[model samples]
Target: MIVYEVFRQERKGQAFAHAGSVGAPDAAFAEAYAREQYGRRGESVALWVVPREAVAEIHEFVDELQKNYHRVDGYPLKEKLKEARERAGTAPPADR
Candidate 1:
Protein backbone atom coordinates (compact mmCIF):
# COMPACT_ATOMS: atom_id res chain seq x y z
CA MET A 1 0.00 0.00 0.00
CA ILE A 2 1.17 3.50 -0.80
CA VAL A 3 0.93 6.29 1.74
CA TYR A 4 -0.79 9.50 0.67
CA GLU A 5 -0.62 12.93 2.22
CA VAL A 6 -3.91 14.72 2.51
CA PHE A 7 -4.52 18.46 2.44
CA ARG A 8 -7.97 19.80 3.22
CA GLN A 9 -9.76 23.08 2.62
CA GLU A 10 -12.53 23.97 5.01
CA ARG A 11 -14.25 26.48 2.74
CA LYS A 12 -14.03 28.14 -0.65
CA GLY A 13 -11.24 30.74 -1.02
CA GLN A 14 -9.50 29.42 2.07
CA ALA A 15 -6.05 27.93 2.17
CA PHE A 16 -5.73 24.18 2.40
CA ALA A 17 -4.29 22.75 5.59
CA HIS A 18 -2.51 19.45 6.18
CA ALA A 19 -5.24 17.13 7.28
CA GLY A 20 -3.44 13.81 7.63
CA SER A 21 -2.22 10.74 5.74
CA VAL A 22 -3.82 7.60 4.47
CA GLY A 23 -2.54 4.28 3.17
CA ALA A 24 -4.04 3.16 -0.13
CA PRO A 25 -3.25 0.79 -2.94
CA ASP A 26 -3.36 3.37 -5.74
CA ALA A 27 -4.12 6.97 -6.67
CA ALA A 28 -7.83 6.33 -7.01
CA PHE A 29 -7.98 4.63 -3.66
CA ALA A 30 -5.97 7.41 -2.11
CA GLU A 31 -8.40 10.01 -3.39
CA ALA A 32 -11.41 7.98 -2.28
CA TYR A 33 -9.88 7.46 1.14
CA ALA A 34 -9.16 11.14 1.48
CA ARG A 35 -12.73 12.07 0.58
CA GLU A 36 -14.23 9.49 2.92
CA GLN A 37 -11.96 10.33 5.82
CA TYR A 38 -11.85 14.08 5.55
CA GLY A 39 -14.87 15.29 3.57
CA ARG A 40 -17.60 12.83 4.44
CA ARG A 41 -18.69 14.70 7.58
CA GLY A 42 -18.57 18.14 5.95
CA GLU A 43 -15.37 18.83 7.82
CA SER A 44 -13.60 19.79 4.62
CA VAL A 45 -14.96 21.31 1.41
CA ALA A 46 -12.04 20.14 -0.67
CA LEU A 47 -9.25 17.63 -0.41
CA TRP A 48 -5.97 17.05 -2.17
CA VAL A 49 -4.46 13.59 -1.98
CA VAL A 50 -0.90 13.24 -3.18
CA PRO A 51 1.34 10.25 -2.98
CA ARG A 52 3.90 10.48 -0.22
CA GLU A 53 6.69 9.79 -2.68
CA ALA A 54 5.77 12.87 -4.72
CA VAL A 55 6.20 15.29 -1.82
CA ALA A 56 9.62 16.82 -1.40
CA GLU A 57 11.06 18.00 1.90
CA ILE A 58 12.85 21.34 1.82
CA HIS A 59 15.53 21.69 4.48
CA GLU A 60 17.66 24.74 3.72
CA PHE A 61 16.71 28.26 2.69
CA VAL A 62 19.04 30.86 1.22
CA ASP A 63 18.83 34.46 2.48
CA GLU A 64 22.20 35.81 1.40
CA LEU A 65 21.02 39.44 1.25
CA GLN A 66 19.74 39.26 4.84
CA LYS A 67 16.39 40.93 4.20
CA ASN A 68 14.63 42.14 7.38
CA TYR A 69 11.66 44.18 6.18
CA HIS A 70 9.26 41.35 6.94
CA ARG A 71 10.31 41.21 10.58
CA VAL A 72 8.86 43.48 13.31
CA ASP A 73 12.31 44.59 14.49
CA GLY A 74 13.13 45.75 10.96
CA TYR A 75 10.91 48.84 11.33
CA PRO A 76 11.79 51.44 14.00
CA LEU A 77 8.15 51.94 14.95
CA LYS A 78 8.71 53.31 18.46
CA GLU A 79 11.21 55.89 17.26
CA LYS A 80 8.99 56.94 14.38
CA LEU A 81 5.97 57.25 16.66
CA LYS A 82 7.94 59.35 19.12
CA GLU A 83 9.18 61.57 16.35
CA ALA A 84 5.68 61.98 15.00
CA ARG A 85 4.31 62.86 18.43
CA GLU A 86 7.09 65.41 18.98
CA ARG A 87 6.43 67.03 15.61
CA ALA A 88 2.72 67.21 16.43
CA GLY A 89 3.45 68.91 19.78
CA THR A 90 1.73 66.08 21.64
CA ALA A 91 4.79 64.35 23.07
CA PRO A 92 5.06 64.00 26.86
CA PRO A 93 7.99 65.54 28.73
CA ALA A 94 11.20 63.59 28.26
CA ASP A 95 11.70 63.38 32.05
CA ARG A 96 8.40 61.55 32.34
Candidate 2:
Protein backbone atom coordinates (compact mmCIF):
# COMPACT_ATOMS: atom_id res chain seq x y z
CA MET A 1 0.00 0.00 0.00
CA ILE A 2 1.15 3.53 -0.86
CA VAL A 3 0.75 6.45 1.53
CA TYR A 4 -0.96 9.60 0.28
CA GLU A 5 -1.27 13.07 1.75
CA VAL A 6 -4.69 14.67 1.75
CA PHE A 7 -5.18 18.43 1.33
CA ARG A 8 -8.57 20.09 1.56
CA GLN A 9 -10.05 23.50 0.86
CA GLU A 10 -12.84 24.23 3.31
CA ARG A 11 -14.51 26.81 1.08
CA LYS A 12 -14.07 28.68 -2.17
CA GLY A 13 -11.57 31.57 -2.23
CA GLN A 14 -9.78 30.02 0.77
CA ALA A 15 -6.38 28.38 1.06
CA PHE A 16 -6.10 24.59 1.21
CA ALA A 17 -4.65 22.93 4.31
CA HIS A 18 -3.45 19.47 5.10
CA ALA A 19 -6.45 17.45 6.19
CA GLY A 20 -5.07 13.96 6.70
CA SER A 21 -3.49 10.96 4.98
CA VAL A 22 -4.72 7.80 3.36
CA GLY A 23 -3.16 4.47 2.51
CA ALA A 24 -4.17 2.94 -0.78
CA PRO A 25 -2.98 0.92 -3.73
CA ASP A 26 -3.05 3.70 -6.34
CA ALA A 27 -4.07 7.22 -7.18
CA ALA A 28 -7.69 6.29 -7.86
CA PHE A 29 -8.06 4.54 -4.55
CA ALA A 30 -6.31 7.36 -2.74
CA GLU A 31 -8.65 9.94 -4.20
CA ALA A 32 -11.73 7.95 -3.32
CA TYR A 33 -10.53 7.34 0.22
CA ALA A 34 -9.63 11.01 0.72
CA ARG A 35 -13.03 12.12 -0.58
CA GLU A 36 -14.84 9.69 1.64
CA GLN A 37 -12.86 10.72 4.72
CA TYR A 38 -12.77 14.51 4.26
CA GLY A 39 -15.58 15.45 1.87
CA ARG A 40 -18.38 13.14 2.88
CA ARG A 41 -20.02 16.00 4.82
CA GLY A 42 -19.82 18.33 1.78
CA GLU A 43 -17.64 20.69 3.86
CA SER A 44 -14.61 20.53 1.60
CA VAL A 45 -14.69 22.66 -1.54
CA ALA A 46 -11.74 20.87 -3.12
CA LEU A 47 -9.29 18.07 -2.39
CA TRP A 48 -5.80 17.14 -3.47
CA VAL A 49 -4.53 13.62 -2.89
CA VAL A 50 -0.78 13.49 -3.43
CA PRO A 51 1.45 10.51 -3.00
CA ARG A 52 3.82 10.65 -0.02
CA GLU A 53 6.80 10.14 -2.27
CA ALA A 54 5.87 13.26 -4.20
CA VAL A 55 6.12 15.43 -1.07
CA ALA A 56 9.43 16.80 0.11
CA GLU A 57 10.32 16.74 3.80
CA ILE A 58 12.76 19.14 5.42
CA HIS A 59 14.66 17.58 8.32
CA GLU A 60 17.28 20.20 9.11
CA PHE A 61 16.24 23.71 10.11
CA VAL A 62 19.25 24.70 12.18
CA ASP A 63 20.83 28.13 11.58
CA GLU A 64 24.59 27.55 11.67
CA LEU A 65 25.45 31.22 12.24
CA GLN A 66 23.85 33.41 14.85
CA LYS A 67 22.27 36.52 13.32
CA ASN A 68 20.95 38.83 16.03
CA TYR A 69 19.91 41.43 13.45
CA HIS A 70 17.15 39.12 12.31
CA ARG A 71 15.35 39.55 15.63
CA VAL A 72 13.34 42.51 16.98
CA ASP A 73 15.80 43.30 19.78
CA GLY A 74 18.42 44.14 17.17
CA TYR A 75 16.35 46.99 15.75
CA PRO A 76 16.93 50.29 17.65
CA LEU A 77 13.85 52.04 16.35
CA LYS A 78 13.48 54.38 19.28
CA GLU A 79 16.81 56.05 18.61
CA LYS A 80 16.06 56.37 14.90
CA LEU A 81 12.63 57.80 15.59
CA LYS A 82 14.10 60.36 18.01
CA GLU A 83 16.67 61.43 15.42
CA ALA A 84 14.01 61.80 12.75
CA ARG A 85 11.81 63.84 15.03
CA GLU A 86 14.76 66.04 15.93
CA ARG A 87 15.72 66.56 12.29
CA ALA A 88 12.18 67.59 11.52
CA GLY A 89 12.23 70.14 14.39
CA THR A 90 9.28 68.34 15.95
CA ALA A 91 10.90 66.88 19.03
CA PRO A 92 8.42 66.60 21.86
CA PRO A 93 8.53 69.54 24.25
CA ALA A 94 10.95 68.97 27.11
CA ASP A 95 9.14 67.28 29.94
CA ARG A 96 8.14 69.79 32.65
Candidate 3:
Protein backbone atom coordinates (compact mmCIF):
# COMPACT_ATOMS: atom_id res chain seq x y z
CA MET A 1 0.00 0.00 0.00
CA ILE A 2 1.10 3.53 -0.76
CA VAL A 3 0.48 6.50 1.49
CA TYR A 4 -1.37 9.52 0.14
CA GLU A 5 -1.62 12.91 1.79
CA VAL A 6 -4.99 14.63 1.72
CA PHE A 7 -5.62 18.36 1.70
CA ARG A 8 -9.08 19.75 2.28
CA GLN A 9 -10.65 23.09 1.42
CA GLU A 10 -13.54 23.91 3.71
CA ARG A 11 -15.00 26.73 1.58
CA LYS A 12 -14.89 27.97 -1.96
CA GLY A 13 -12.05 30.37 -2.80
CA GLN A 14 -10.24 29.34 0.40
CA ALA A 15 -6.86 27.65 0.81
CA PHE A 16 -6.66 23.90 1.27
CA ALA A 17 -5.32 22.63 4.59
CA HIS A 18 -3.64 19.36 5.42
CA ALA A 19 -6.47 17.02 6.36
CA GLY A 20 -4.87 13.64 6.86
CA SER A 21 -3.40 10.63 5.15
CA VAL A 22 -4.79 7.50 3.56
CA GLY A 23 -3.09 4.30 2.54
CA ALA A 24 -4.23 2.58 -0.64
CA PRO A 25 -2.94 0.52 -3.54
CA ASP A 26 -3.70 3.14 -6.17
CA ALA A 27 -4.59 6.79 -6.69
CA ALA A 28 -8.28 6.11 -7.28
CA PHE A 29 -8.73 4.22 -4.05
CA ALA A 30 -6.71 6.80 -2.18
CA GLU A 31 -8.98 9.53 -3.51
CA ALA A 32 -12.07 7.55 -2.60
CA TYR A 33 -10.76 6.95 0.90
CA ALA A 34 -9.98 10.62 1.28
CA ARG A 35 -13.47 11.58 0.12
CA GLU A 36 -15.08 9.16 2.54
CA GLN A 37 -12.91 10.28 5.43
CA TYR A 38 -12.89 14.01 4.83
CA GLY A 39 -15.91 14.87 2.69
CA ARG A 40 -18.61 12.48 3.82
CA ARG A 41 -20.07 15.09 6.17
CA GLY A 42 -19.70 17.86 3.60
CA GLU A 43 -17.05 19.48 5.78
CA SER A 44 -14.72 20.00 2.86
CA VAL A 45 -15.66 21.80 -0.29
CA ALA A 46 -12.79 20.20 -2.20
CA LEU A 47 -10.06 17.66 -1.68
CA TRP A 48 -6.59 17.18 -3.08
CA VAL A 49 -4.96 13.80 -2.79
CA VAL A 50 -1.29 13.41 -3.54
CA PRO A 51 1.10 10.55 -3.07
CA ARG A 52 3.26 11.01 0.03
CA GLU A 53 6.43 10.34 -1.91
CA ALA A 54 5.76 13.37 -4.10
CA VAL A 55 5.82 15.75 -1.16
CA ALA A 56 9.11 17.22 0.08
CA GLU A 57 10.00 17.70 3.73
CA ILE A 58 12.14 20.64 4.85
CA HIS A 59 13.95 20.26 8.20
CA GLU A 60 16.90 22.64 8.23
CA PHE A 61 16.96 26.42 8.18
CA VAL A 62 20.11 28.57 8.04
CA ASP A 63 20.64 31.83 9.95
CA GLU A 64 24.37 32.27 10.04
CA LEU A 65 24.37 36.06 10.58
CA GLN A 66 22.78 35.85 14.07
CA LYS A 67 20.60 38.89 13.46
CA ASN A 68 18.61 39.99 16.55
CA TYR A 69 17.29 43.47 15.78
CA HIS A 70 13.79 42.21 15.02
CA ARG A 71 13.37 40.70 18.51
CA VAL A 72 12.02 42.74 21.47
CA ASP A 73 15.06 42.06 23.68
CA GLY A 74 17.36 43.41 20.94
CA TYR A 75 16.48 47.02 21.84
CA PRO A 76 17.46 48.59 25.20
CA LEU A 77 14.02 50.08 25.71
CA LYS A 78 14.24 50.31 29.54
CA GLU A 79 17.52 52.26 29.49
CA LYS A 80 16.25 54.50 26.71
CA LEU A 81 13.02 55.16 28.60
CA LYS A 82 14.97 56.03 31.78
CA GLU A 83 17.20 58.45 29.89
CA ALA A 84 14.21 60.09 28.27
CA ARG A 85 12.37 60.41 31.57
CA GLU A 86 15.44 61.93 33.23
CA ARG A 87 15.84 64.44 30.43
CA ALA A 88 12.15 65.40 30.67
CA GLY A 89 12.39 65.84 34.53
CA THR A 90 9.65 63.25 34.94
CA ALA A 91 11.82 60.52 36.54
CA PRO A 92 10.65 59.15 39.90
CA PRO A 93 12.85 59.07 43.03
CA ALA A 94 15.58 56.37 43.04
CA ASP A 95 14.35 55.05 46.40
CA ARG A 96 11.46 53.40 44.71
Arranged by TM-score with the best first, the candidates are 2, 1, 3
Model 3: per-residue Cα lDDT over 1-96, one tens digit each: 999999999999999999999999999999899999999998999999999999999998775776668667678789999999999999999997
lDDT of 2: 0.93
Cα error of candidate 3 at position 5, Å: 0.9
lDDT of 1 by residue, 7-95 (tens): 99999999999999999999999988898999999998888898889999999988787787877778888989999999999999889
lDDT of each: 0.92, 0.93, 0.94
In every candidate, how many clashes are there? 0, 0, 0
The digit string of per-residue lDDT tens for model 2 on 1-96 reads: 999999999999899999989999999999999989999999899998999999999999776676768888778899999999999999999795
Ten contiguous residues minimizing lDDT sum, candidate 2: 61-70
List the candidate 3 regions with Cα displacement exceeding 4 Å. 12-15, 70-73, 91-96
lDDT of 3: 0.94
Q: How many residue pairs clash in model 3?
A: 0
